[model samples]
Target: MMTILIPATVAAVLGGFALRIWYRRWKQQRIEANRKVEAPNSYYSSRGVRQQEDRERWHSIKVGTLHPLNREEVLRLLDVVDEDGVSSLSRKDRLFLDNMTLPRMGV
Candidate 1:
């Protein structure tokens, strides 16, 4: 009876340890697979194109060729100032124009 009990107890303990190791490996593999699935669609891929477009748009606005304060424009000059910065306006007159027209446009 004692011999049988000792062998059975040892076997149970070894089986428990094996199960724990297997569970850990399975969990690690699942996490890695999830990361692979989710990582590619993130903003990392389009960052360069988005940045380039933003730079060109800002340059056009700064040079006055792309004035947002124009009569049929969707965004006002103040919207540009708020999204970009006041330093992008280049002159006090442009800043005053933005301040004046933005309120009239209900921006």
Candidate 2:
């Protein structure tokens, strides 16, 4: 009876652990499957209200408007963040980067 109980208990614990791991992987896959993305047909036109908004956005990002975080400065800031996490940034650096817009790729 003792020998039988030991083997059964071992099997039950191992089976439960395997089931837990499987369940976590399944949950992650389910979350990934349900993730949201922008619609392909979504469109914005540069006219009327949109035109004015774009102008304002451009003005807001204009030099002398922000704290002198140019494209090169922003790139260096990103490199620092990559090397030593966001927490390593100075308060001023964090404020500057957080408020600045992401640069256009291939620019």
Candidate 3:
């Protein structure tokens, strides 16, 4: 009886220790995951800078005004559309295309 009790008691203590270690590790992993989720990626940070510059350029242009682009400028935009889908164009680029096409549409 004494021998059986001693081994069972030892196993319970060891199991408690094991559970404690596993719980601590799980908690640490959760913290690390949260940090990763919260962290700002450098790629996105740089993209944001580019986007801000585009916004500033967009603001400088007058609305409801026809701003004609040079041949190279027009080709550059077309090349961008061909390389990357139309969805890749910024709001200002889309507006430029819209204004340019409006006259051709006979509207």
TM-scores for the candidates: 0.45, 0.39, 0.34
The per-model lDDT (C-alpha) reads: 0.56, 0.65, 0.62
Better candidate by lDDT, 2 or 3: 2
Say which candidate scores most in TM-score. 1
Candidate 1 lDDT by residue in tens digits, 1-107: 99999999999999999999999999999998888454654545465564454434433444344455452242454466568764465565364554433232112
Local error of candidate 3 at residue 43 (angstroms):
14
TM-score of 3: 0.34
lDDT of 2 by residue, 1-107 (tens): 99999999999999999999999999999999999987654464435654344334333444555454376576676677667655566878766764675442232
Error of 2 at 52 (Å): 4.1
Counted clashes in each candidate structure? 0, 0, 0
Q: How far is candidate 2 from the true structure (C-alpha RMSD, Å)?
A: 15.4
CA displacement after TM-score superposition, residue 2 of candidate 3 (Å): 1.2
Q: Report the candidate with higher TM-score, 1 versus 2.
A: 1
Model 2 segments more than 4 A misplaced? 39-107
